[model samples]
Target: MKFNVKRKVIMQKNSILFVILSAFTVFMWYFFFVPPPEQSYRQTAQSQNTAAVSESGDNKFKRADLNESDIDNIYVKEEYINIETKQYKAVLTNKGAGVLSWSVKEKNGQWVDLVFPESAPVMANFPSLTYKIISKSDEKIVFEYVSKEGWKITKTYNLSDLYMHNLNISVEKNSKTPFPQIDLKWGPGLGTDSKELKENISLTRALVYTAAKPNKLKKLKDNSEPASLCKWTAIDNRYFLAAFIPENSTDFDKILLSRLDKKHPCSVILKAAEPKDVNKKDYSVNFYLGPKGYKHLRTYDLGLEKTVDFGFFGFLGKIAFSALTFFYKLTHNYGWAVVMLTVIIQILVLPLTLKSFKSSAEMKRMQPVIKDIQTKYKDNPQRLKAEMLNIYKSQKVNPLGGCLPMLLQLPIFWAFFTMLRNAYELRNEGWILWVKDLSAADQFMQFGSFNLNLLPLIMGIGMFFQQRMTTVTSDLSQRKIMYIMPVIFTFMFWSFPSGLVLYWLTNSLISMVEQYFIIKKMRLSS
Candidate 1:
């Protein structure tokens, strides 16, 4: 008495409900993912030759309005220390021995400056000038600063051939008088990704690796996270991540916070808890600032790759995402990589696709018989269902076949959707004419606030034709409603990434061709 229920049939029967669900999912992403600016804590030590920097009470940022007289007497000879490795270029000014600019060659083959602009107060807030440069090498720079209180602070930076560096901070013995606990801060956070500063700030936030697993600091008011002693911390946006992983986190508490100021919301910050006297003076940590490439982050082994949100299909999404990058490398064109990915996936699922459609055809052929049986037992609801099952059993139609193929394909679709949205390789990469920057919405023409994106429109037309090729219900109203779904989806996808829209359009076109042949053979045989 057991019968295989076709879930795809249910979907085809309730197209209106499915359309609403799909559209809602797409709406949510448009709000969550977007881009912002960096800021620094610029207040230098209030008193010269002092290690303590006073925090400003004013929250608003302002520029000093100085004129000719202010600049005329400023004949200060400014000098800076330069460090260059195979991966990045860094300049440190004596102001605080902090980095002025840290530039790295990105996947786009351009040197991207990751430093906060001059507007930020703490852009040069690193390599704390409280320490003085005592030793230097081609790959290593060491600084030692001794306070008036006889407390010595030592900081050493070891450069490498990559975008990562090792930083070690040590303190000389001062058992007589204990030094006041100070914040070891690194800010303003990551640099801007998109031209829109507001969007960048919206996506920028502090991410911490804690015992409760990795969590993003949403509100600046949540002051407890940094004092919670997390293992590591990061400030990242859609494309890049700047992470700090301490060697011995047990010795001190860690806190990661952002100023959340409107001027530069995505500013970087690192405030560690008081240094415990473990009878040790030196502590080590690693700093990584670069693109969050899937393979690159995974190899770091510090859980940096967790920043990539794979959603429900985590493992499957990872595999498919890796394949997408692999195909992109092979074709050298992300547009073609998308096409190739669709083709490869369709080929692999061809058997399931055929099985599902065959089931659909069988049910189509049995519709008349099912109707007659229903009419024969119209008065007996129970008997009607029983007879319908008998008719389905005789015809050997699997109700679940139609849905199984779609369910199998969903993970791949979602994987493409997630990866293409933020892939840095597609940041400014273009496909055909008018389809520029696959990571953004494909706008061929813009009329002020309005845009004419041709891909989603074409994709919608393709969906319409594919629906037309299928058997439409006799009810004219339902058929009209089905046609409206394409229009709804078209508008919903208007703001989605071009790469994703391209994949969908490519998939729809292929489906249209596939259905055409399937129908032709079925007609010829009949």
Candidate 2:
């Protein structure tokens, strides 16, 4: 009677352990393997709302009172200094701290605006304020306050007189300045829709001067700034302009604007100063306004490169981007380059994956032996683990080999995912038929007002077939759960970039092929 009772207790413990382990495995599969459904819903909603707002025809700027000023009229002077270079002409100014206004005339003689905001006004009750160019000449120009301000200061800097043809400007002190604030604006000549502008116009990049208030850095908000602010403004049919502003300062808001002519491709302007006794000594304020190309941006020593956000998985993204760039140089096409790189990566890691596949096949072969052991040791909980380990060791099989390959591939997979998402070169690149843009969905079919793509459907089908081929689960319930995964993934990836889907589909097909060959060879050997 005692022996029977002990056997029953051990069997119960073994069953419980099995149940817990199985539950844990299922939980991990759901948590990590399944993509979030909320992401799809959010993207759809955002797209719909954006389309609706675009159709509404609302002017965001017209709603604000831009002609009001609450501060006293302080003495302001402006100057325009023209510098000629081999490629282009730059107009530098000393009216503001840096280049108040500069324009680049292309070889086609079309002028592009490269204006930077040095300073402007901000008020408590009004929408954000801006400055508008009233007029400009070779020697002097006038600017009107285009926004409401409690207290405002404005200046311009000219580099023509400097031997180096570089200008430095500053905005010094705003102790009595009420609600001190500044606005900087720039954009492509094409205006943004009010909704998009409102949503996207925040300081995503800036070379902020923290020398004045180092301790206050922690208080700086993501979208708000105490000293410097940047914004985009559409100047004319020919030019996109951006303004940079430095608000109330205990010391001078100094900026340096280099006069490289057309080689620089843009201009920096400074505009701000508190009313004080005039001094003759010149204060240098450094600033830059130009194309966002990596080479152009690197001229400034400040850590301005942080603007490139590579999502949550940035480290992997960096590696992927480096590799993609290297491959792109060789192929001269990003789309083909991505494919080749993926193939190379797969080939390099093939041995590890092959080893893992072999281990999984060994495990599958041992399943019958495992089942027999489970039945025999049904009354011996500790002995069952020992027996199972012993059996695996004797067969020279690793239970975790399959899992290790998957783990090794995960980082590379994520890196490639990021590479595809942000590769600007892939933006308009073509692949096969109906996939004109790798960066966008292959919208080959449309259902009344809603579009369905060929890639997502293909991806779903591929996933289903792949899952069916590889799934070794004998449990009917587990097989059902496994089958549901492909459907979930299909829905999740339906709106992702076509390039990502292409990569996944190609990977799945390759995996299927590999599994087939490996399994067939194993069966033949056995």
Candidate 3:
């Protein structure tokens, strides 16, 4: 009987935690759906060597041309060259010596193309004309074109086995006249979106790291910033990223951002005009296109890890991610890694769990006497409060004991929620036979637009039993309200990523077991 009372008390405390979890989930829902405010673009000092640049209504950079002539009349047979590396395979075309397509390998051994099919070549023509391949190799490629007017353009690529690669663009003008603005544009979008894979249009956005801040471009406006201030610029979705890092800040004049329409993706343009008396101009940049893993990004030392949004409790989220990856290194499976992470967290807070258990048990022991006091003082509010304090003091029970320990752990709980939702490692990771992808819903059946996710249903059933095990209050109306929370949560988490749902489910199950053991230990001590 004592064990049952202790179990009931502990289960009652668990219900309170779930109440807090419901509030947290609602806040997160609001945060993800509501777009943030637009950021004001910075207009800092421009480079002295370059001409002034302004954005036109068509989302193109406009500058005064110095007697520029048509250079597209010369055409050569277009050819393709394949560059294969350990990390990715890229196809380049001689049409503009630009990237025709680049696909990065996912964990499931599937190639996901990063090039937006409907847009122009990722790094296409500076003059919008063909260039003949001067040199070609597995690791390096070079293309050069010379117009009849003596305007020369050359593109060089030094490939690597990793995500980071080098690109160099040089323009040589034989005549003394200044050449048109030499620029490199990477456009339209990053990775292709698929509804089946849960990739949505809202997840895609362009970002820039400047002045030690990462600014996400969400506004549909044209903006330009000094190249000297930009460390890197990127277009990324929820999982993958395509970024550009200027090797030398002085190599470019301005970094331009533009979008033709709200439906289209933003474009990034790097412009460097040849200074007077200097006939040749060179620009070098490093390109990174791969998954947004924190470990993978931190190696660049350029703050690329900022692309992974860890929320307000970022430090805790980082700790959780590090712990998660540490277990992944041992398990070799992200699904199992999540389970191990959940177990480790529960163990870490075992002491607090025990304290909360004891506090609740003490409260349960005094319930009979406390109820009598309440009935005796039902007419005198001030006397009832005094009597309650007297009983708590005499029993050596802290009124806030059970709740305070749980409150202290809210940040950790939230950190796990934020981290799991954005965890790139969980992408395409499988847990069991039914769960093929931890990053998506574990749908057992799909009826048109409705997806019947089994994990959430199982989770809801667990919550129902958890609430049924204990009554937090004797009031009939309040008990009915408490039972409704599980149903609300079941519907709320129905579409959440399976990895996050798995984490919560594992935590809930572990809490039940921990409570059982704590209750048993308490009974033995008595």
Candidate 4:
């Protein structure tokens, strides 16, 4: 009878663990492994257009109605001007007085160009007209174009520290005609490499800062008529960003996004506000084209840091990342920093771990007594429940003890998961032998044509032993399923980033050690 009671309790614990494990497996599978949906560009663009129109209720705001007509019978010499700073190098062309290319220097001594080479007319308002170089210098360049109608367009670029720069545009006119529509644009796609863009295409998006927050636009869509006015607009990917921040939000409120061309599928456009007077119009924009580093973005005070999506438990993830960076500052090695953070986390959760271990250990010891009581009350279900309750009360055992601890730890696990996966600091950063890049899977050895990741395997082994120490269930089926959990996790984590796997590995090792000592101490007390 007592055996039945112990079995029921064990079954309840196993069921909870199984449910939680399965849920986590499903979550990880969807987020990390599943490929994005495949759709045609035309279908995607139409869908986006429909959604945008519906959201706006009416098309009061004009679309990015830039005229793409050729400049007939007009000749202007084209010139390319290059500007180099310690942080980045930018090339500008007199053809449209727009940026030809901007490449930011990385710590690994590699240049990550933000502009896609295939996407021409990048960040240009007038792509067809060639402008004359009015002025050129090491830090600044000015281009001017005078139309046959006697209207002049001048674009001046001023370099600033880091990846920040300023573009001042002015139009001088002597006509009663309306001011020509102007929009600064960038797109098709932006990323560190083609592979990154291809894999993380879903992460690439257009963002408009409006109403004190960012309103994100759908990817691969013709979103050329967002409803609200924006302070700025941008095209951002997983690691880098190219944004246009108007010096005065009032002057650049209309934001447009278009993916009309197959070659240039995503274009972010920031339209200039209509000038009250047609005689002269001037606009200044602070352009930021560089990494999405939290520290760097925070310095700009433009809320660019919001671009980093930290998931639901973002507050905790931010704190975890902060701690990680703090430890890295001390150790000067991210691998060592991860180890330190894991140790600190284990220490903080020690109280919950100790309580869970004690509850499970106590329940294991009460099995024999519980079985005897169940037998005595075999025919009396109500009395059996009452007696079980009495025994729990006397023993100070909370039936939910073990389950609650696991539940409480889940938030921390998810927070770390989100933080480590999106951590830009881990990219290309090496940890130890064969783990050259923490952001990539650790390939310790090659078995013929198969590569084996050593970290996840070790982590799996640690998890198996940790479960073995804590598991009190005597049911054969439950035990089998419980034992298989480690193997299942091994394969799931096989392709995960090494830094994330290292955190889990260190966690499992710590839990096993803690469980071992707890078991030893319980035996001594008995």
Candidate 5:
């Protein structure tokens, strides 16, 4: 009696699992998969050689054209002062006192470029366009530039222990000179390392973080209108991000955003406000340049982490990412972390998986008998229906038992997919030899435009095995049709990120193992 009660309780739990999983699967596929925007990033030294000197050639924001061979030759040869932290290294040039390079160090110990000077238009005066370094110290650099009217402006940048910096700008004046609204414009574009500029340009835009939420503005067109207020703004990209956060923006209420040029589809933002009325004449802001790692970005609580978009299944994506990171903390390598996640999820769903596989096998075994019954009652539809029900009851098989459990797990699968596609941490991380950059394709060779991706192929092969291993009961035509799915998915996922392909492939291999043992046990018992 105790065993019977325990059995009923277990059955009820499995029944609930089946209902929820099946419903989620149906809903997900019925609606199709849709995801949301937009971005995340890292800071690295990938300076573009192209230099565009503005038509106005304003001294306040002038850059050496390097168009003339003489200047180009001299520019590269010139020394730019650098400041380094544990996570990043920044190079500041005397040409504009602008950032020449910003490189981030990744887990593989490989340094990559994040700042794309060619596309990025300078915005703020903290590093005033062309300043002489009057004084410097470890983790700090001060730049000075004198206006033609005799106003000496000094911009000091001090590196904090975090992946950020403090910018303090003060103007020295003996006489009252009406200081024009403090205008610092940034953009042209962020650095593009993984993809073509046009392919990623749309993803690069100005982001303003308000008290309520962050707003992504493509271009700020009308300067006459009052600018929206925000705590910070960033130049966002698909995998890298840069933002300027004012230390005190209470007075910085006005903003101007404009298009730089058509060649690069560049966007620029001029964040300005009247500072004369403020108690302190100095302006200060914090600048952050780095990858959009959730754990890394969440430290500041400024909604900066929202840049790492998780799409439609954000709630699930966050949970999945947290799990992935949790495992990463234990395993260190992203590849191993994925494997660990897969193992844990698989174990949790094992009971339902086993129940489904068993049902499928049983259904397959009863197929021969069912086919005979259909023929026996060929013309009698009503009789055939009744006969089929009895046979199922006698055989103690629930026809939906196979599909329900499998369907129940699809939500998790979708969540996992969404998380991996946007997880910035996977960008430069590796799994094994030759499979660097899990966020990208694991392509080993390219012939013309056709590249060979080994993982997807392995995924297809495992899929084929799993397909073959799945006992087919419906019809010979259906079995043949099912064989085509592996081929379809292989090509479809051929160009997908390595991390995604790895997860599917690992799932398939594990499923194949489980199916084999389950089928063997069921057959022996029968």
Candidate 6:
């Protein structure tokens, strides 16, 4: 009797394991594999339009051209700042101080303005502004800004082209001379009430520059606004790069520059203000505008390195990138790398999964007994509990062991999730047989004119097989739920990246093979 009880307990444990594994497989397939319905561009554009017009009237700026002489009425300042670095020369200007422009002489001797817009029409009244120009060589640069009170602040720094160089700013003003100041006031467009600019600064073909500053950057009031501004200074007819310091307080200084065009590698150096002696009559500051590169940005440890934004999943993204890169080097093909990596990861986890599979098979064999117990216990709960515990103790089976492997897989799955979404190395990468790009959906088979991707279909088939091989349900409701899961998963995976689908398909195939071996072993042992 005791031996029978022990056998029964072991079988019951296996049955529970089977249920859990099946549920998890179904959940993963349903949630991660299904591709959402595509959204129309017109719909997206309408949504953006609604958001842009939602702001209160006080914060909105009227569109106008900066060339109009009426801009002078706003009290703007202009200056020229020149920057020289090892690879290139650049001029930064604050033309009418309303626009910041950058012109660079490339490595191949071509002149290009990293800033596309030469003039940014004035939209608001400035409380305070400063312009600076620095030159390491005879080449000219410009800087410009407008002030409400017409007080002009311009400084220049000269450094050699050979040394590791930067431009810094330190503001020192004379208390006696009545330093440049803008009267604080409020109203729409010219005062504190001026709504954030809502214009779209086209970056499609423009050279983009990300800002670097010590303080927290202010969030743009409107999402449609350009991430940065393009402006030029008329000083010496040279153009410089300028962007608003969204949040300025106390002595904190902000830095902005044009995007890095490999041909032009000039640098920009800017510094924060420091306390000055009481007798100082004039305010002084330093500004550097030049090259945008990795080595140059690392000089200041202000998380400026994050401009790379590997993607939303930071550190995980870095690891995925490194792993993908290493795999690419080994196989000389990204698609092969993805396949090999999937196989290796699956193999590494096989031991735990094998145990889970064994546990599941044991449970499937015992499901009839569990159902009998449930039926028997319908009248006596206490007796049923006692019988269940005795059966488990005798069989030497752990109910929790099967769940451990799945719990361990969560992080690895998440890492792969981020890897597929953000790794640049996979971009435009091609795979074998009808799958041209690993980064994009498979395009070989289409529904009508729309292409039905080969990989997602393959993934759906694999998942169906995986589900069929693993699920053990005697309950009618449970069986219905299990059957529906694969169909839902198939739809979900339809639009995901082919690389991700490939990984899922490979994992499913491996699991099916493993399940086969485990089942065969169970039958032989029984």
Give TM-scores for every candidate, taking all chains together and pairing residue i with residue i: 0.75, 0.57, 0.80, 0.83, 0.73, 0.54
* Candidate 3 lDDT score at position 350: 82
Of the two candidates 4 and 5, the one with more favorable lDDT, higher being better, is: 4
Q: Is candidate 1 or candidate 6 better by TM-score?
A: 1
Could you say which candidate leads in TM-score? 4
Please provide, for model 4 over 1-526, each residue's C-alpha lDDT reduced to its tens digit, 9 standing for 90 to 100. Answer: 2324556666786785776588577758645665443224333644443333323221221322223222441355667888877788888887677777888887767787887555543666555567788889977788886765556779988887687789998988775545666667776556465335334455667776654444532332544644245556788877888888887877764676665444324657676767774589888988899988887798987778877767679898899999999999999889889999999988988899889888988877777787788889989977888899889889988766876897798888789888888777887788988897777789899999788999999998998988787776565766776788888788888878899999999989888888889889989988
Please rank every candidate by lDDT, starting with the best. Answer: 4, 3, 5, 1, 2, 6
Model 6 clash count equals 61
> What C-alpha RMSD separates each model from the true structure?
7.2, 12.2, 7.1, 5.3, 9.0, 12.1
Candidate 3 is scored at a TM of: 0.80
> Against the true structure, candidate 3 has what lDDT?
0.71
lDDT of 1: 0.63
On lDDT, the stronger of 2 and 4 is 4
lDDT of 5 by residue, 328-440 (tens): 89988899899889888899999999999988888888889988987888687667777877887888887768878988998888889878987888987889987887988
Report the lDDT of model 1 for residue 468. Answer: 67
Ranking by TM-score: 4, 3, 1, 5, 2, 6
Candidate number that wins on lDDT, 2 or 6: 2
Q: How many pairs of residues in model 2 come into backbone collision?
A: 33
Off by over 4 Å in 5: 1-86, 94-96, 124-132, 148-152, 171-177, 195-199, 202-205, 213-229, 254-270, 276-280, 370-398, 444-451, 471-473
lDDT of model 4 at position 261: 43
Q: How many backbone clashes does candidate 4 have?
A: 6
Candidate 4, residue 54: lDDT: 27
* Candidate 5: residue 422 lDDT (0-100): 78
Candidate 1 TM-score versus the reference: 0.75
Residue-pair clashes per prediction, in order, are 23, 33, 0, 6, 24, 61
Model 4 quality (TM-score): 0.83
Compared with the true structure, model 5 gives a TM-score of 0.73
